[model samples]
Target: MMHVPPQAADARAKTGIPVLDERLRGGFPRPSTLLLFSDKPTEKRLFGENFAVQGVKAGDTSLYVDFFRAPQLARGELKRFGTIDPSKLVFVDATSSQLLLPSQEKYRISDIGSLTNIREAIVSAIEATAPSRIIVDSMEFLMDRFDKDDVLRLWHELIEAARANRAVICFLFINWTLLEEDLAQIRSMSDFVVEFQSSVRGGIVRNSMRISEMAENGIRTNWIPYAFKDLIGLTVYFPRILVTGPFNAGKSTVVRALAEKAISIDRMGTTVAFDYGNVNITGIEAEIFGTPGQERFEFIFKIFAREVSGVLLVIDATRPEELPRAKQMLDLVGPRIPYVVLANKSDLVGALSTEDIAHRMGLPSDVPVIPTVATESKGVRDALLLLAEMIIGVR
Candidate 1:
């Protein structure tokens, strides 16, 4: 089974995003600064809000300083992130004073013109609450209104305050007009740099985030595609995952094990057309397509192979000779696609070990070869989840 070792509680602050937390070994390091830089603003805020709500759910104080919205409005919008303790989510309202309106939040920015006022308001909130997590949504507003040096000072001050409290702070920013040198400087000050990008393809907007750690031997994860749930927050998402192998490799069995509901087209107990299912796991959802494993049904691969997020290459561990045919099935699916090997029927007497199977198939050392008995549902979920980690570049 796939496993992510747990870290010390004091070492990290959990994001509460299931797949992401698994990869992070809990979450971002405590007493850290994260630069959430994006080309655009709208998409990145989702991640920030999720982080704040997660802190609240984890029983930690969260200080959210908003320069764009009223405290009440921000609080109302945050409800979409699911249930959070009202007392834990404290906000600094920066818009109400500009509109000459009475503020409901404990902290309010009275004068937008004064950089000193904004800095003090935020500093006071941090000092009073001793928050375990902080989010500035966002820095662009001040960056637009103040001098670069003044804004840089405010950024440094907030980081210091968070460090003092052993808190994790994220600064959301859009690259409106900053030079590369300034951007580099900001990145250098941060413990992690999270970059966001969005694109429209076939009329569907796809959002992705990439995280880069600044320490020696720090990790750089691939662009992980994600989507926000109505009230559950951010989740790692994959639209389609394909499963294939040689004849009688239990491709259909593996699909049924991973999916909540499944269907198969078969002839004489042999899948002749295909098997399909929908899988919903903690903070994840995917549609699984299992291709027929016989040479006569090879054309089925082309129909559903194009745009697969990942693949589960299943082979009967007892029949090592069938491994070549299994590789041929993958060849037909195309190349450069992420895949994990399932050594199916591993419980059988003649079954080969995972390492032996990998050597027989000539698979890369990095490719996972997990032992599984799909009919009994053993190691099935782990195989699929490992493939997800591969596709998301977290493993």
Candidate 2:
């Protein structure tokens, strides 16, 4: 008997969601089955498409089996996220007889009615393309067309083929009309299950996700608010990153410096809900969030703390008295997450040194305390760079 060595265990790949990837330890197990379930159109399909595109862009061949959407429409939608090499992405159209031409001649169609023909078409696509990753846009459509047994049989064949070829397979399933037994069967065949749902609370729609069956331990994460940007893709916009201090502190100016463009959601020059900005920094690639220093909007801390990679706790060097509030907010985000303190408005007269600000904030001796003037963008870059390092854990 040939025994496979334990060291040969395949490494999982990240799905690009940092928090989610942490939950999966590394990422989804390669050459394993994954089921994406969502009843409503919560961008679940789009998420799967992007996941496959990421693999293809990384020089791995990928196959997208679309059962509902036309091939051209899918390709067009994917292009909005980023450029995908036409040579790397191949599509199998099980929806239409007419081949919706892709940017290149890499896409093909399978006969919708013939089971044998469909299977052969899939095999040919996989063999010809030699894809490292595969996504079936939906299994629900396949279930609707064939009997449960036939669908299950086809699924088994596909899973076996993917395993033999060392390819990861993602199956998308819409759960509206699916019976519980069918779902159970699908779950049994999958190594990972991701569920997306949307709820309306107080006239506001909120989207959330949960992951189950990702390895030995099932993973869970706090619900983070996200919105789909048409051209840029998904973004998490936290409303505030409170920068508080005594009177004459440079909290307002600090907000402006860190953000690309910011609005002081304050009244009479005092922040209420806090400061808001859609800031993006090069090489770091994250949403920059800031808050007000006032005490009234302390409730917003709970919202901002969720799903945060790291915190940038900014304070004023001129006001040593305001250091307590910065410490208080740091405690709110918990100690496990990395954070840095910024001594803003340092260019002004009588501004405390970086060491004094750190000591006053009760921050760790090694914690970074950057001195800056937010208006001129001085020290802002360093503060953001430190935060990014804390997020990815290099610095």
Which candidate wins on TM-score? 1
Backbone atom clashes (below 3 Å) for every candidate:
0, 6
Q: Whole-model lDDT, candidate 1?
A: 0.87
Expressed as tens digits, the lDDT of each residue in 1-395 for candidate 2 is: 22211323656655655444554666677667888888767767766876787676667778999877777778887887677687788888776663433333345554577777777778777766667788988887777778878888988898987776667789888876777897788789988787888777558676655567755645544444445555455543332233444334565676677676777766776665656565654323445555655566666667766756667777777777777777777788888776777787788899999877766666788789888887788987777666654544434
Clashing pairs in 1: none
Q: After superposition on all CA atoms, what RMSD does each candidate show versus the true structure?
A: 4.9, 6.6
Model 1 TM-score relative to the real fold: 0.92
Weakest 10 consecutive residues, lDDT, candidate 1? Answer: 1-10
Q: Model 1: per-residue lDDT, tens digit, 96-145? A: 88898887778988888998898889888888888888999889898898
Best by lDDT: 1
lDDT of 1 at 345: 93
Clashes of 1: 0
